[model samples]
Target: MSALTETDPTGAGFSPEGLARIAPWMDRLVDEGRLAGLSVTVARRGRVAFARACGQADLARATPFTLDTVTRIYSMTKPLTSVAVMQLYEQGLFQLDDPVSRVLPEFAEMRVAVGGNRAKLETEPARRAITVRDLLTHTAGLTYGFMEATLVDAQYREHGVDYLAREGTLAEMTARVAKLPLLAQPGSAWNYSVATDVLGQFVAALSGRPFADYLREAVIGPLGMIDTDFFVRPELMPRFCATYAYDRARQLRLFDDSVETAFAKPPAIASGGGGLVSTAADYQRFCRMILNRGTLDGTRLLGRKTVELMLSNHLPGDLAAMGTPRFAETSYTGIGFGLGFSVMLDPARAQILGTPGEVAWGGLASTAFWIDPAEDLSVVLMTQLVPSSALPIRRELRVLTYAALAD
Candidate 1:
């Protein structure tokens, strides 16, 4: 939609030639109907190296994508939610291993779904309470709204606890979620779940402020991320890109937004798990803070130690529970889960050619971004497609980004 495909006037590590190298790959994706639109940005040493928009925001509609386009970032909200909790962590309000129930009474008597079926939920006192750290690392036995092909999905649907819906505040949603059975015991395994949302609730309860309010005061406002929020403003709504899904026929389908859905702005439910809408520039400021070790420009968001804690791995030997059984040593090497982001425990295990101790994550909209401390590189690739978890295209982009490095 917006092509500065020409060389950078600033020549900040990225040349126009670097962008041209990826043009064919991006063009190929457009031609093959693989993506509706893409907004790509690469930064090195805290400066924007390259930023570009290509193709239509909706491949099916031919609506051209632009720099201001907004796409649902889905799970990309995790890192931000994680940061919010860490702000509390810096205050010494709670320790990483503190039992979650200590702060939120509802989680005190939590139970697990013993029979693997939501209907078979049997009450059993967990050997240990889910800890604040557990929520951040996703090891708190929480489960996504959709887990198995069985009763778990049914239970989620019946509860009306729409995670993607923008209805209730984080606390309200947490109260509803607490009534459900946990999928596993705390600290025993990894599960991609609503734990971070719960963490957001914890943030509100501890801070005595709404989650969004706390985030804005503690992080967003401090960092100057003015464009990000749970709900897009009336004026900014025009920049919101149309959402699309790739069908079996490899065609893009325009998906209608549902008011009842979480994306429409809930009553108070600010899902720390997946309720954020961000721009490349907005998120780059965040990555820059991480790259700067808890500070950006001259302001400090967290201490250096706190930032390290977030980027370090906290996983035990429960890869299967974490849903990473297929991960090999090369890609997962020294890689582990930290408070809110993926810690690169083993650079080789990460499969991508990144620095050791690099931390990164992506959104479900095919938005993948990583902050590589070793290389002093942070890259973000944003698009409007759902379920962007597929590897080849993302992997190719990562490789290409690395290849473009001047070294």
Candidate 2:
């Protein structure tokens, strides 16, 4: 029942007793069979205040979850991909409003679904071309195949426009996506689509290298995210954790074994929307960079103004109220989608303990991280569970974290 604590590097005020509550709460979830394992890291004013891991990394093997245990961060990869695109943006490579067709000719001719279901769909010319901004904000006329309720979503599935399919290269998969009809017109509605994956291809096109290679050489390498990548290396496979999903009985069931996961090998497509394995420490560095206004350890990835623009809400006049279906457990009531993460507009409307302008995002496996520039704080929680909505753990973690601030 003992939890590990790290000496506060910056000596930013934090109550030891308040921080003490985290591990026990996390342990309770593991003991209750809600989580196979979990790791939490909290920092304030650039100081490491709390770092702890509980339960097993691989329950079948009885492996203990450690700080170094790498886990699939899934959709959390969006923010990182956004940063890469912004790096190119900083270099005058492309403007946010530029038509995506300028770089990826595949999107030059796109269509929008007019009516009918997946069985008999009707199409018409797009009102306007999809832009780079649409890709960053999920306002593009794209849709994910898992959103089967929509006819365009069904088309996405039928055409194999999957982020995790591991079948063809990103260019090929995106071409397949282009062949499908868009769910909405550009800048009209929000659909959590493969827009970021398209952004990754855009990055590669702009950087003159493979998306993975540019990400490594430009962002990951410069930021010192040594353990973050599209695939885990052979020697590091032992540190990879198993993923789980709840069964019909509401008990833990193996989803993906650590020893036998697609992440252990190079993926055919580097999914910018939901692909990447990283440790808590590695992700913390990435968060720290964002909180520090795009610089960490003398490495500058973005300009201060660019980071400010990324954190601001770009949706027009309460577009968050456009009633987009909640693909995950997120409540968009008082939330706004920024370039890469969700920005809290009003604390009361969100009905959660948070500050305005706080930005955060999570993964399909339940891993999440948030950066609070107002308080100079960043919190990261890592665990492996499918359908991240299974538990309200992220909200709970936020409450526990904000209440622990002593300053």
lDDT of 2 by residue, 82-178 (tens): 9999999988988999999999999988889989765799999998999999999888989888877788888877777887877888888888888
Q: TM-score of model 1 relative to the true fold?
A: 0.89
The list of candidate 1 runs beyond 4 A from truth reads 1-19, 59-62, 116-119, 149-153, 166-169, 257-267, 317-334
Q: Count of backbone clashes for each model?
A: 27, 0
As for model 1, its CA RMSD to the true structure in angstroms is: 3.6
**Mind giving the per-residue lDDT tens digits that candidate 1 earns over 75-121?**
77889888888888888898988898889999988877767444455
Residue 22, model 1: Cα distance from true site in angstroms: 1.9
Q: Which residue pairs clash within candidate 2?
A: none
Summing lDDT over every window of 10 consecutive residues in candidate 1, give the lowest-scoring window: 1-10
